[model samples]
Target: MKRNKFWLLGTLILTVTFILSACGNQNSSNSSNKQVLTVATSAEMATLSTTKYSDTTSLEALQNTFEGLYRFNSQNKPVLAGASKVSISSNKKVYTFTLRKNARWSNGDPVTAKDYVFAWRKMVDPTAASPNSQRFESIKNGVAIASGKMASTKLGIKALGTYKLQITLESPISYFSELMTGAPFYPQDEKIVKKYGNQYGTTAKKTVFNGPFVVTNWNGTNLKWNYVKNKKYWDKKAIKLQKVNVQVIKDASTAANLYKTNKLDYAMLTTDYIKQYQKTSGFHSKTIPLIGYMSFNTHRKTTANIHFRKAIAMAFNKESLVKNVLHTGSTLNGIVPKNFAYNTTTGDDYRKDAGNMLTYNLKEAKKQWAEARKELGKRKISIELLTSDTTDSKQIGEYLQSQLETNLPGLSVSLRSIPLKSRLAATTDYDFDIVYGTWQPDYADPVNFISDGGQYHLDDDYNNRNFRNLLNEAATKYATNPTKRWSTLIKAEKQLIKTDAFTAPVYQGGTAYLLKNKVKGLQLSPYGTVLFYRNVSIK
Candidate 1:
């Protein structure tokens, strides 16, 4: 009886052991099935519709699901996608493209020429209210129609067939190709747009992917997300990763912790942490296309005078700010930096032409302030500075407040910090004395810096004060002449600096994220747009 009992016990133990081994194998297989790159980005999406996008966070999310007619290469120059050939007419008025029939959306729908036509028209349509419509003015009549002078259909884009598209333009634009590879021109399927009317792209499930990944279970505020591979994507073989997960974290310290714990694959270092982490393992940094500056409310009674603007611009010791507030990159003297921001005509660089004394000109600034005080009644004026709650923003605001007061005796400045969205609204409404503003270029072009709402000519052109009507008029001349445009842009930038009208502040550059060594194929250009994340992978 004892021997039989022992034999039964041994048989039961072996059976249980086999079952547990099978479960372990199953879990490993599931994990190995997909390679996911987890990204930590704030989950603020502007809008699902590519045209109406205003927020950077949301646009980055949408870029994963939709396919543009042209997509940016690692260098940010446009490359043909669904299109087989893209060419401009000799006169530069006609742009033609032949589509590749092999392209398919994630839902197995054909990506056709009509899709491109519909998307382009939808963007510039006055009713479309697309923020990016201004980016496409080089397309035939695109400028006039977008300005509301011409009819929506009058804008120069049309589909000749299921796979061919031609864009007519009033003039030539140097950065047109770069614009094509980005958002405002991305094609939307008529079938999908029609199926989900106003609700389309409002949720994660309503959209389809023609790019490398599909966003699943996305919420506007999720610190986490998934970017699943699109098997139907035209270049699926080049996409090795099966998924990408995005996690939002506001604190750089927390981000570092995540990277250390193996919870994050990549992380950005704040100025406070840059020095400490540069000595630790896995540290990296690079420059990006962001420009951070303080926009003084020229509309304010006390601040309205141009001298006040010049004084404020002069107060910024860019070199000191870079050393104290920003530790990661070089201090840029001009608003636009070198190796970036070009002129269309001679391709004269805005940064190179910008005279180099990156250091502050106290004497020049002081004289401007004196002139400003004489223009105004007050030897002393109390002004307010506004900022957001981020660690970087608050510090910058506090620093500015201190600098202005210390440098200029008559300047009494107060500081206030609010949420980012509210601060943006305040700046737009001219609600404060001075507010910090940042601009990320829509496309790589000289017009990007000088144009309003992405277009050059508007009766009210709210984005710019139309600082130089001469420059604006000159830009119009270059509307067809690229060389002439470059010279005019240079002249405008020079005049802008000479007057101390505005400071570019900090040329926020690329981020050197500490990415997990195993991660691969996550590509970015020096001037990267967050919206082009289709081909990124983990392995």
Candidate 2:
């Protein structure tokens, strides 16, 4: 009897030991399967809240974790992602989308049409204070709700069922579908959002993701963050990377050094390092639709004079600035960037159609300065220039100050390099004489930019009712007529650039980067400079 009892005890112990050994092996295998891609960005993500933030840094992070009804693919073309099917009305003022039934949040909650409704309403809520709410002004009652004239519930989006969503528009916008691919239009989980209140999206554990990856290891203000593949994503099979590690290295030299040590898979190149790596194997140079320009505060005494603005615009050498200083990007001939918009009739680029309106003529600038001085009844003028504190921005600001002071007699430019958010606030508060600003296109349409309610409109004090009227007519009367709309917008571009000189178009921005050869399938889209990493893989 004693021997039998001992044998049974030994068998049970062996079985338990075998189970524990199998579990340990499984965990080791899982750890080995985790593949991480490490990269570098210039700045930390300002905010993860979709509606409150409108910068590319935030958008890049959000797009990887929270998908919209539509998404730009690896080729930068609009493709359906969250939505399975979409139908549009004949008048083009209404749209209906059918969501993917299998899509679920990282918390295992089903993503429904009601989530979209909640997000859209929150975006335009009067109390929300969302800076990006204006992007949805084309939706029915969107402008009214944002302006506090209508209730948030009255905004033009509704859910017909668990998966069907309907939207009404005030007018037929050609780029409406493309606009839906952006981060601002992504859905938010109402219950989760409300549960967290002000703490939502402030930490990795506080937010829920439904896209390809879920943010992890973020402390809301850390220099580093991680993206872990979400197993619950409906299209998880297509996501090749198991993890992505991003480090914020604001200095270009530091980023290059990290790349050299194989610590980074990608690094952005500034003028200082472009020459050294121009012939490197992984180096690439591409121009996007980012436009860098100078905004003059028309309310200021010296800048209020139209001739003075024109003199400042023509005095600077754009070509030299592009080649000698920037070492990247092309000189801008007009406000709208090159290869940004197209002519529906001839299929030519809008910049090519408009031709070059900005000129670099010292003689003409001197003549205009003389007229400006006579008009102001002052021999000397001083203006303060506000710009971001980034290395490239500081370099450009110092160069501008030197050139403007040397080329234009009796004119002095004082440059102030502030943080990005602070610079934006200063522009909104009208606190500076001039501010160096860069704008990325929201969509393909020219009307989307260079129209009323833009930064130039707020800053430029020039009384150009004719130009404003032209823009309004194009936006409304010619909204559906592609040819006429393009023509009218072209006229507006010429007037703004040539006749009024509302803002000086400096250059079309470009990004030069060093990417590892193994990294494949990352794309930079035309709309809003959105980056798509859905197909990116390290092999």
Candidate 3:
């Protein structure tokens, strides 16, 4: 759906904490005055390559290690990074950026315009298979290059000088500046990439950093790593946290214990810990732009029936799912969540306009199930539910299985727990009857949510040409008309999710965490990357 690609765990790592204290590379001789902050994350990074997998963990790491032409400031607004000045044409199809003279990589190499060119070419190269390549479709010929209709050299990015970069767009996009802050748009060094080949970004040594921190102690496999402040960073003075220690803790209880023991400066809280630490000091509930939904495989005979699909969609109670199960977030109204994006015309929330398309009514569900059974001449159906192997994912899967089977009689649901990679593979390959899914926006637009990209691909057999056409029109024909564009995309979302029931929205995601009161300057932005630790410091 959206490629901000941070995976939001369905369940809290409330108790799982792997011991990485002995695994850290922080030498005993390091400066005693250096401020260090230890934080806990539920999962390990799959890769550091920006154009590769669009998962959340890798994006979190990328945000601290790389600099694009622009970045989201603490206020979640796009601010210049590598570029000192940027100019736009009247038609908004052309953009010119002048790079900062002091912009240097961790290795002290000057970040040149050619670096952006190289990265852009690599991302759109058919062989690269970058999930993010399609994001450049807004740019002139970007779609052609990604679809293999045009050579990578035919792309619209150009370098007039070592420090000057120019970009030509296919049309005027209001959120172009916000898109610049995405990980895929960040510059990459051609020399280093060629030298590393397939091994690029596989390990700390293989990667280079140009942002606030240079990653260290990562041998490519371990869950423990450190972000040491980059001395060569152009804005190093603003970086207060000298070192940020990160440990992958799968257990929520273990993370809470670590936070309680001062072993971790920050830990995301579960329902139990939320109440346990509400008055303690640094308990914060952050509303993020992540939407969790249940994706059904229409290829399955039983699921292919619209009556059966609506029965399944309405059988589960979203209120209980968010309140009793999630306990931290609100129930989702539609595919898009609340406070995620707004209507450009009215400035009101889009969720309010979409209203509640999904509702829980056991009586209505049974009626639909009976109609579906009569159509198929079947009294009962069995299917497997797929989810990640993590503690939270398994728990959510179990809860869903129990709820679905219990509420809808004669329906059987078997749970299959697999590794994150395998879960993604199974879902992408359409190997599961139903599976857990998440989508996070790459920019500040609802179009990112409605657009058919990333993990939002439904089955191919269920074609809605009108829905697809509306999306295309919104991106092109109505790109400048905020009101028409918003209305068009809203209709598309309704067609895909509510009317057709391609996806079932369940919950709006929020991260409740416990942090030391002394910690400051860490920005939990709603767009782009999840957490920014550059200016973070201890009081």
Candidate 4:
């Protein structure tokens, strides 16, 4: 699933209103005596429904409130959570999972294998309209079911009695175990879902949780929520924090003030504030495998031209954008981020193997623009660039507007900044010439980025048969051959970015944040939920 950063500037007032309206003062507990952690988030969660939610904030919320068969630990390694045991068939296609007998939801109902079957089937059902339906294509009959060629009941997942679950895959996935840690694979209670129907995950009361925490006070659109410890959790003893108070604070200065006032246990720093807090205590930063880029609508008139796309791609100065504007990201030369997805045989990073495909050259951009203008038989071209109304996104959109208009002679770029939700809707409808986008991998694999990033969904009219074939071959024909698969994936990336210029690669994401000294055992991961609060404790 595609994850967009939802930091909207105008929502700050709404966030404050919701926080103030929250019942009582949850943060009033004595910090020294109570295991309560107060944190500030940059964005509000879209929804709690695992089958529908797409943004990172909602994924993180779901990760904390729901237990899957496996969960990523502090080391970013898969660890057992709901399932007590797992067995695989000799053919490596069938997996049998045994649910923990003690595992029960907040309602005291034993979480059975039926929950897994229900959730899996719902996600892949064509009528469900899940944006992440393609993620389950590896499951047996998954593609047919998602495409409406087969009934959802035919999906290769079965509940073998009350405690055991069986899953059949069409082909072997190297990262199958790691993939189980994602929220899409988590179980959902059939009874509760049927009862609530469309309103199931819209509010805190409508959802049931079996993970380390149970969400509270979230009324679908609220900016403030609480994560109270689930007493019925199987491993409740391991959960140290009794409650977690989360509030959305998009402004970096507001977050900094909250952090200094001891109201926030964790806060993310923007570029302007990073320098001020660099020498302060509890300051940390890490480079995550997040690729930020721009997606061009190939169906649009001027953007449809390959030369026009190439001109726009080479016009932007990513180095200056990352260093001078966004201080917490690294400029990218390829679709894959550096230090991610290494070759097993040679131990070479995929980025180094792929080499540089994106570069900033005003001379080349001008040349391409001339060709594009000649081919289109137009002297002037106007395009609208759609972006989220976040501070970072606005800065990026402004920079690109200035650079594109200045470098490309006959081009006029207009900026359209909207809320994250509105921007996503417009992008899905292909309502803009170009749009700013970001993609974080679902797991530690190159295919996750290459396939999900833009290959299948970027532009409605952008279809390169060769690029698609290479990816399909890597996933199927070379499934077990790591070396061949790695080589094929590299070729596919080059085809998409260099040869086709379907999308422009921006910079890799780096996160800088402040955590209180009292907060310990917080796990920061590159994939899935970046912050794992399962092991977090308040000193």
**Evaluated with lDDT, which candidate comes out highest?**
4
lDDT of 4 by residue, 107-196 (tens): 888899999999999998877877667678778998678778999999999999899999998878878988888888999988899999
- What tens digits encode model 2's per-residue C-alpha lDDT throughout 1-539? 00000000010000000000011111233233335566566555556677655445566779899998998776677889999999999999889999999999999999999999999999888687665666676788886787688999998999999999999988788788788987779999989999999888877888899999998888777878888889999999888767777766556777677667766566667766776778877888878777777877777888877799889888888888889877888998677888878887789988887788877888988999999999999899988988766677777788788889999989988889875545655665678887776666667877655652134433124446776676657756887777887878888877877887878877777777777765667666664344556787654
Candidate 4 deviates by what RMSD?
Answer: 4.0
CA error at residue 529 for candidate 3, angstroms: 7.8
TM-scores of all candidate predictions against the true structure: 0.82, 0.86, 0.89, 0.91
Q: Candidate 4 overall Cα lDDT vs. reference? A: 0.76
Q: List the lowest-lDDT window of 10 residues for candidate 4.
A: 13-22
Clashes of each: 16, 0, 14, 0
Model 4, residue 420: C-alpha shift (Å):
1.9
Q: What is the C-alpha lDDT of each candidate?
A: 0.60, 0.72, 0.74, 0.76
Off by over 4 Å in 1: 1-33, 74-77, 106-109, 126-129, 190-201, 221-223, 341-349, 356-359, 370-380, 410-416, 419-422, 425-432, 452-483, 495-504, 508-510, 529-535
Q: Give a tens-digit lDDT track for model 1, residues 1-539.
A: 00000000010000000000011111234334345455665323424677645545555666666667677676656787768898888977688888878888889999998888888887777666555666665677776676678887776778888788888765666666776766677888889888988767766677776787787876543445677878888888766666566655545667667667666665666656665677767776666655555555545666656677767776767767767765655665555555667654456666676555324667877887888888786688888887655566666678778888989888898888765445544544557777654445656665555443111112232234345554555535667666666667666655554443544354344454565655545555335435345554333
Q: What lDDT is obtained when candidate 3 is compared to the true structure?
A: 0.74
Off by over 4 Å in 4: 1-32, 261-263, 454-456, 459-462
Local accuracy of candidate 3 as per-residue lDDT tens digits, 117-136: 99998888877867667678
The top-ranked prediction according to TM-score is: 4
Selected candidate, larger lDDT, 1 vs 3: 3
Q: Please identify which of the two predictions, 2 or 4, would achieve the higher lDDT against the true structure.
A: 4
